[model samples]
Every structure is written in C-alpha cells, then in structure tokens.
Target: MRALIRFLFLLAVVAALVLAGAYYFAGRAAGPQIEIHRPTRLLGRTGTLDVSIQAPGGRFNDVTVALTQQGRTVPILQLLNPDAGGAPPDPRTKLTQETGDRIRVTHPLDRQTLPGLREGAAVITVTAGRPVLFGLRTTASSADRRVEVRLTPPKVSILSTHHYINHGGSEMVVYRVDPPGAESGVRVGQLQYPGYPATGAGVQADPTVKVAFFALLYDQDLNTPIELFARDEAGNQSRASFDYRVFPKAFRKSRIDVDTRFMERVIPEIADHTPELSVSTASADELLKAYLVVNGDLRRKNAAFIREQARTTVPEILWAGAFAQLGNSQVESGFADYRTYYFDGREIDRQVHLGFDLAVTANVPIVAANAGRVVFADYLGIYGNSVIIDHGMGVQSLYGHLSSIGVKPQQNVANGREIGKSGMTGLAGGDHLHFTMLVDGQMVSPVEWWDPHWIEDRVLRKLREARSRPS
Candidate 1:
C-alpha cells in the first residue's frame, strides 16, 4: 500500500509542472504592444488633424488623450463609459508579464479642442487599460505622438464689384479655396463670415472643384472699419480689409417721344380686355375720355400686371436699332377690307387717316415681347388680321394690321418668337406694322421692354439692391 501511494504522488507532481509551463508561455505571448501614427505632422492651427493607432490583441478601455504645447497639456478627448458623465482615473502605467496586453486607439483633432495650441508643436499621449480580468491584474500602457501645428495666411478676394456704395443691404461675396486633402475623407467645419449677421453666412462646395468655402454677405452699412476673414482645417486664419463710402445709388433717365394718336387707338382695345372697367366702347371720343379720366388708375392696375410679366428675373434678348415707316392715310371702306383709321397726334380735331401704319415693312415678322397664351387671331374693326397675346400678370401685346397671322388664339408663344407678318391690312394708304404694349388696358412706353440693359440695371438690379431706408 505504501509503494502504490508513492507512485501516485510522483505522477501528480509531473502533471502540475506541465500546466505551469503552458501558462508561462501564454503570458509571454500576450506582452503589451502599442503603435501610434502621426500622419500629418504639420497642421493648420484652426483646421482638422487625423491620428491613427494600432494595438494588437487587447481591448482598449478608459483611454485619455491630450495635446501638449509649451508645457501645458490640453485634453483632446477621453474615452470612458459615455454613461459615466466623465472620464475615469488613469490606470497604473507599468507593463508586467502576467498583465501585459495589446490595445489600439484613434483620435480626430478639430477646432473646439485646439484653440490655444495654434502655431506650435503638439505632443499627443494616450493612456489605455482595463480593470482586472478573472482576478488577474493588467498594466496600463501609454504612447507619445508628435505633430506640428502652423498658422497659414488666408486667401481672400472680393466677390462683388470692386467698387460699391453703401447701399445698406446684404451684398453677397463668394470666397473659396481647395480644402486640405485630409478633409476630403470627412465633412469639415462650417465656414463663417465675420462682421456679418450669423444668418447671412453659409458654406457651400464649389461646383467646379473639390474646394469648399463660405458665401458671406454684409447686410449692414460698412460705416466702420470692416475686416474680411477666412479659416481653415487646422484653425489657420487669413484676413483683409477695405474701406466703404456712402454714395447715391446710380440711376439713368431719358425721354422717349410717343405718338399719342397711335396710343389712343390701342387704348380702347386694351381697356376692353381689362377686368376692372367692366364696360368699354368702340367710339374713339368715348375711349379717349375713359383714358383721360382713369389714366392714373389704369397705370397703377396695369403696372402690377406688367411688372409680373416683365422678363426682369433674368436677362432678355433685345432687337437693336429702330426701323421707321409710314402707313395708309385712310380707313378701310368695307368690313371685309380690314379698314382702320389713324387719328392725328393732337387730341383736338382728331382726323381719321386711312389704314393702320406700322414702323416696319410689309411681311416683316413680328415677335412677341414676352411669353403668353394667344387669345385673339381674327380680323375685326379697323384691324386687318390682328393677333393679341395675353402674357399673364395683367400685361398684353397686340400685333395689328398684319398681312398674315402665324399663330392662332390659345396658342402658346415664347418671348421673341415670330407671331405674325407686318402689313397695311385694315385701311389703305401705306404698309407698316402697328406694335403696341398694354398694361391693364393702358398703353405705356413699349421702348422699356426692348432694352435689355435698361431693364436689368434699372428695374431688376436696383430693386434687388435697395435698402429700406425711411424717407
């Protein structure tokens, strides 16, 4: 019995030795290893920084990282239980065979955390570890990473006209440049335009390039010294300054000679289509009376309508120069003959001249000044075969005494498209095209619609730039 017991004890000791050797080798294999990659050593103080790290085989927890500049450490980030409200205390920083393990961590530097560390070299340190696992203590590890932050001059340029008066409203200026290559992988911070209302500045990507920038506007008067600034990924900044002067907004005025007789003839037709009048007459005297009595009212009503139809939103194509001609001197004798009369320019002794006279030659194609739906395309009164297009917004265009009508009523016509041929159709004297523009049934100057630059600078640009200055 004593000999059997001795053999069993020897076997037990051998088994214990094999198990201890296996554990020792495993612990050695799990030695703590850490790697830190500082891809971009030079960073813009206000821009973004990207850091990468690699740790083998161990889970990283409670990692606290900071950027150090001039002996002061600025906490970049701390990885902790998000539920804990704050980062946990650092673990012991010793590596041992029994507790050695591997871990990895990465961090992104942005504007908020790198405020004071601009224009200097920065050191990044990471502390990582976890609590005891199965009653075995583990050692925490740290790695030192270095990066250089530099301040770069900004690129600033004037987006608006080089010279502008204090119009006292928002003026848009676009400033842009290519973003840092590192920012290509992620969304960069919002671009802000200083010295302007917060709502007025916004960041947008350039349509033609990978660069992004802010479109900022100065909505208030530049009475004081104004500075323009831009910021980049590493928080680098650039700025420029310009002086502003208060000057009267520029405007131009010119007088256009209008033939009142020609205007009077078309007044009745325009008024007949107006919704406000509700009643109209074919008599020339009666029409003239309505025009004189309600001329102001008609202008107000029609101005609203005509402005709506004006091609003021964008630029318009204009016909250059004016073609002058004479028309028939007598009215058409028959209803089928398309007879119309021209009254003399004077209000008194309005003599009837035979035929409608246009300023263009016979068969000259007439173009519609604006886009609209055609409402009339037939012969009536003294107008031979006439065409009327109702361009919505209370404006209408009439091409009268035409030799031929290319469009029918209810047909859609685009701006500057040929709609009819000019002719002396109604009365018999000479051949010319009678063109007219009507607003709310009253004839204003047709010259305004034919001038592209005038409409843009005067009507469109001025309105867009106007500041609500109290009179």
Candidate 2:
C-alpha cells in the first residue's frame, strides 16, 4: 500500500511540472503590435513611410515591411535576430532604430528609391514577431493598408501678360491650372500669395483660370524671383515663369522725437491693453522699455493679426472703383517711411512706418475707403481702436487710431461711408487716421490703389483681356 501511494504522488507531481512548462513557453497568444503612421490613404510620387513595432515586454525579434502591387512585392525594411541565421537583408532595407523591445523604421517611397513603381492601388504590409515557445516558434502580428499611388504633377501656365510689379507695390496675375481644385498661387521669393477663381474676380473665364494679387514688398530685393506655382493634393507641384518686370523705387527717411509725456500716455495705455507683452509700467525707465516692446514686438503681432484677417476675405471683387483717400486731410507720414526715434538727443530705435498717417481735425469722422465688408473692429495693439475692411481678392484697407467705431464686423458699407471717428486712442500724438492697403497680407503702397489710372492699367485691363480670351 505504501509503494502504491508513493507512485500516485510522483505521477501527480510530474503532471503539474509539464503543465507549468507549457504555460511558461506559450502563455501569450498575441503577437507583436505593428503600426504604420504614414501612407494611410494616398501615396505620392515621393513620400516617407513611418512604421513602429512593439512586442510583449518589448521583446521583438523579427520585423518585415513590404509594398505589394499587381502581384509584385517590393521589400522596404526587414530586421531579424543575428542568432537566427538567415539570408542577408536586402540592400534597400534600412532600419532606422531598434531598442531592446521596440523597433522604428522609415523608408522613402519614391521613383528613385523604388524603381518600376506605377500609379495604381498598392498595399503596404507590416509584420512583426517575437520569440515564443522557448525560441522555437514566433508569435506574429500583421497590418495591411491600401493606398492609391499618384505620380503626375499638376500643370500650370500663365494666361495674362504685362505683369509689371513695383518694388513696394502690388500687381495682379491671371493664370490657368489644369486641375481646377489644385492650390495655385504666385510665389515671390519665399512669400506665397494665394489665387482665387477668375469668376470670383468678375471675369467670365474658365473654371481653371485663377487670379492672384501679389506684391513686391518693400523689404524684398528688387530682383526677387517671381513665378506661378501649382500644387495638387498628392504633393505634386509645378512652376511656370511669366513675363514680368520689377521697377525700383526710393522710400523716405525721417526722424521722430519722443518725449516723456508721450511715453507716459502711449506706453502705459498700450501696456495696459496688451498684457501678453509682460512689460512693467511702474516707473519711467520701465515705461521706456515697455514702449520699445510695444513698438517692435507688439507692432509685429498686430500686423500678423491683420494678415490673418485678410485670409477670410471673399473671393469676388467687392469694390467697383479706385480706393478713396481721406478727404480734407493732410498726409503727416507717408508709406514705408523709415523713422529713427530719438529721446533726449540720443538715438533709441528705428522702424519702418508702413501706413500713411492722415490728420484733418480732432475726432474727425473716418469713412470706408471702398465698398467692402468690415472684417475686424476692435482695439489692436499699437494701432489702437482699429478697423480692417476686406475689398475681396486679397485686398484690404485698415483704419487705425479711431476713438469710436460705428460699424461692426461683417457689416457691408458703401464707398466713403463713415465707419468710425478718428482720435488719439492708440499710440497717436494727436487725433488722426492711420490708413493703408494690404495685398495678400502684405502692406503695399496704397498710393497705387488710390489712383484711377493705375487701377485701369494694372488691374482692370488684365481682367478684361483675360476674360476676352477663351479657355
């Protein structure tokens, strides 16, 4: 009886050991997790494929990625354990990073990288595995993504001629893009001015025809390269050079004297209104420091805000005639005036005055420069109590230093309509109106828009000529 009992106990112990071994080797049924972040829907002619892999306890041993199309497989990346001796990896496979338990891979999917690649539906397969069952077997996971390949670039060409742009002025370009929905524009050096449909500009032309109002900003070099560019959704791009000329112009330079009283009035008010500047207004020295910050940093912020407002303009032309200048007003400061600031007979700072400062009388009524919708009506930094009106097609007018605004945002006003009352609410020495014209967010010479002949020759004639031509 004792021998029989001993045999039963040993048999039970052996059975438990076998079960424990099996559980330790094949406990986890799930494979490594694979993630492909790029090439989700469409694959352009040239793009990067980003992939990540994670294993149980970060213990990946093998990973493979490939692109499959039309019964052909192109290997992108493959990583295997050196101990698991196999054939060498393909020369094209590039492994970016490999940690103890995770792996990252990045490969370029381009014509030069992958030859014989055609435009069609393709599948990217990512497989990852980790050692299981004591290195005898592998637990693997896979993910497949289907994407469409696009290789052809969008076509772009100029449709209108006589594209003359002044160094500090604005010009309009009429062009055509093969794909109407493609984003087309005028590229002046690094600055991009977006194009709108010609129909919106009152031109009964083809849908693919676009009109863009671009500028040769005052700061840009006189010989900056200008060209028309078009880009499609798949990242395909093309450019075309048009016949254009750049005329050089000279700007005025002047000196501005700052007084203690002006600092106390302007600096304190601007600092109080602009808390983001984080400037101290407790003492005279601090007030001077705050003044510098407002004039430089706050001024740039205000200009960026105005540019953002220009983005929401309507596509069609809203104004009918030349922009109207303030009546019975004297131009105190001209556009692009390089002003040097002096306090106590010492040079303090210098900045370019972008707008024309006009003064008629204290608290004079300010009117709309043209027929357009008021896009912004509020207190802007440095400009103080300003209003910006959109005249459509990337053209806008700004009226600053207003004591009170009568029109609200989105309110349409006719030409010469009174919109506000001018005052010294902002950084103004006396009650006046700061007016300027913006072309595609660039502050250009408003003098061009104010002249009827310049408008007739530069803008109106281009539209009429483009409309006369067929698609």
Candidate 3:
C-alpha cells in the first residue's frame, strides 16, 4: 500500500511540473506587455495642441485614443488593424505574436475641432491592447489626463480718431489690425443705423487693414450714432462706436445775371412754327425732378443707339465750373410778365438769380464731359434749346441755353465733342452755357465731378481696393 501511494504522488508531481512549464513558455511567447506611458490630456484652445502616447516593450497591435468632454466621447484618432489575433501555443489570450507590438498614437486639436470641445476642460483616455480569442482585449489603461481649452478671438481697432462725415453717399471707414493673421475668416456685424449701406471689409499690408464702409444719409439730421462689431476665429469679439453730426450748410446764390436775347428769339420762332407752345417756369427743385424724368425717358428710348455708338468713341463733353460773364448782360424781372429788363444790373429786387451764369460767346462750340448718347436735343419748356446726355449708372448731364443743337436725340457723342453752341436760351439773361450733373435723379454738385483728382482719390481708389480684396 505504501509503494502504490508513492507512485501516484510522483505522477501527480510530474503533471504539476509540466503544467507550470507550459504556462511559463506561453507567457514568454506572448511578449512583454504594453502600457500607456502617458494618459491623453487636453490642451488650451485658440492654438495647436499636440497629444502623444508611448508604448513600452512594443507589445500592442495598435493604440485606441478617445477624447471626452463633459462625459461625451470625442473621436480623436482611429486606428486600423489595432489587434493581431493568431493561434496560441498556450491559448490565444496568453500568447501574442511578434506582429502585435508597441502601439502609439497622436491627436492634434485644430480649428476644425468641435466647438464646445475647445471651450472648457476635457478628458483624454488611451488604451493599449491586442487581439485575443478572436476579439480585442485591453492590456492597459492610461491614467486619466485632463486638458483646458481657451477661446481667444481676433481683435479689430479703428486707426482714425474721429468718424468721417459727408453730405450723403458712399463713405469708407478704415481700421487697423493689431496682430496680422487670417483676415478672410473674420466677420463683421451690422451697424446701428439701418440706412447705412453694406460695408466693404478687407485687409491690406501697406496702408493697414482697412474696412471700407458705405453708408447713406437720407435726412440731414445731426448726431446720428453708428455701431460696428467684429469677431475672430477663437470667438473673440471687438466693438466700436461713431457719431455723425449734420451741420447746417450755407446756400450760395450766384450773383451773375442771364441774358434773355437767345430765349427771346427762340420763343418767337417756336411760337411761329408750333401752334402749341409749352412754356413752364421751373424752380431749382422742380427743374431737377424734370431733368431726371426726361433723362430716364431718353435713355430708355435710345438704349441700343447709345450702346452701339458710344462703345467705340470716347465722351466729348467737358465739365466747366461756374463762370461769370465779363460783358454786359440783361435780366428779366419775373416769369409772370415781361415787365422790366435790367442791363449790367445788380438788383436784389424783382428777380432772384438761383444758378450761376456761365458766360460764353454766341456760337462757341460746346462739348460733352464724357461719352454718352444724346437723349434730348429739342426745345424744353423754359430750358429752350437744350441737350441732355445719359452717362449710364444713373448719371446724366444737362446742357441748357444753347444757340444751336449739334447732336440730335439718340445720337452718340464722345468726350470733348461739340454738341452745341453757347447761347442765351430758356430763361437766361446772356449767351452762356448752363451745365448740370445729376445722380440717380438727384442733382449733385457739378463742381465735385469736375475735379479729376477727387474722383481718382475718393471714388476710383476705393473701388480698386474693394475689387482686390478676397471674397
């Protein structure tokens, strides 16, 4: 009985030894275990944030990284073929092939990252594992890592001290940027006043980052305040305020007198020819409205004609400033009745001269300031022998009190081309040309358009700069 028991005990000991050896060999073949060297961490916002993972002993097929913000998992990185599963000498779980080794991953936080993800603190978790038993098994979990993201937006500041104010049209507001960066991504908020036109925002390297804003003033009320706002990529914001005070402007009445000889002659001839003579006395305001209506009608009628003719020729009309006549002139009292006529007279009595008198010798050649089509070259109510030209884009020029009309309706004329001769027509006092400019039906100061330098610096320059800016 004792011998038999010893044999059985010896057999049991051999079996135990074999099992222990097998377990040892299996663990060795599996290779060294891999652990996350550093837990995934959050980085501040508004800039690049780099995260890295380290695998010790290189015993992982791949590394899985996840970012969590406010308990929500964020997809930071995705690994392909993360687990290497193969037959095992000592079970698949225990034995890892040479293919399954160290695994490392990296995640970068950029502008494209989730919005709230960059706002506050976030958690990063990294897991290292390999394929075992036809499934992925985590070998080690990284320690919890936390990161803070900050929101930093761009900044905007106006370089000028005071806001620019003008009569009523397009205006540019220039601003300077502190740190030059990506300007295309910036957004500008609307102004307080709704009447202001859309603003043209852009950046420049030479003069400075400029935002050319266009605003309109319908009413002449002063002390109007306008607000502007800007925001950057990181959610940063800036604001500015400007006020415009509409001051009273003085109205200057031209002291020069108009000679009525030309008008006197034309009216009698027109009466003799046409049985019905249309005679109307128009004030400055009424005359402007009439000019617009007539000009528009003429443009519509001669659209094709103007386009075909002016396409090849430059404008011939030239704009001259208000001038006074050196020779003797006579003025009629009023439109009511030809009661009194004054020669070389300066009277603040009977009739008030509303416009500046342009004195030119009779039969002197008159030209256009720009290329355009003649819309009207007939007798106007009180304008007498008049010619109106359409210059496109809601701009029109008028020449009244002409001795003779050279260009007929629908005729194209080039700049500096003779359209008529200076004469005292309509309700004029002398033989001189009357020139006027209208914008969108409203009469603007002709003096401004006459200055080429002003147009280049203010109008053309802004347009060129706006076109060059990136959309």
Top model number, lDDT: 2
- State TM-scores per candidate: 0.31, 0.89, 0.36
* Global lDDT scores for all candidate models: 0.45, 0.86, 0.46
Model 1: lDDT of residue 285? 63
For model 3, the superposed segments whose C-alpha errors exceed 4 Å read 1-248, 254-356
lDDT of 1 at 260: 46
| lDDT of the structure predicted as candidate 3 | 0.46
For model 2, the run of ten residues with the poorest summed lDDT: 82-91
How would you encode candidate 2's per-residue C-alpha lDDT over 271-294 as one tens digit per residue? 777778798878889888888888
Inter-residue clash pairs, candidate 2:
58-101
> Residue 9 in candidate 2 has what lDDT?
100
Higher-TM-score candidate among 1 and 2? 2
lDDT of 1 by residue, 299-409 (tens): 354335433443221111121222112233232221111212233534332221211234545577777756767767775334556776775433456666677889987
- The RMSD (Cα, Å) of candidate 3 is 22.5
- lDDT tens string, model 3, 278-319? 333244443333333322343233333322332332222122
TM-score, structure 2 vs. true: 0.89
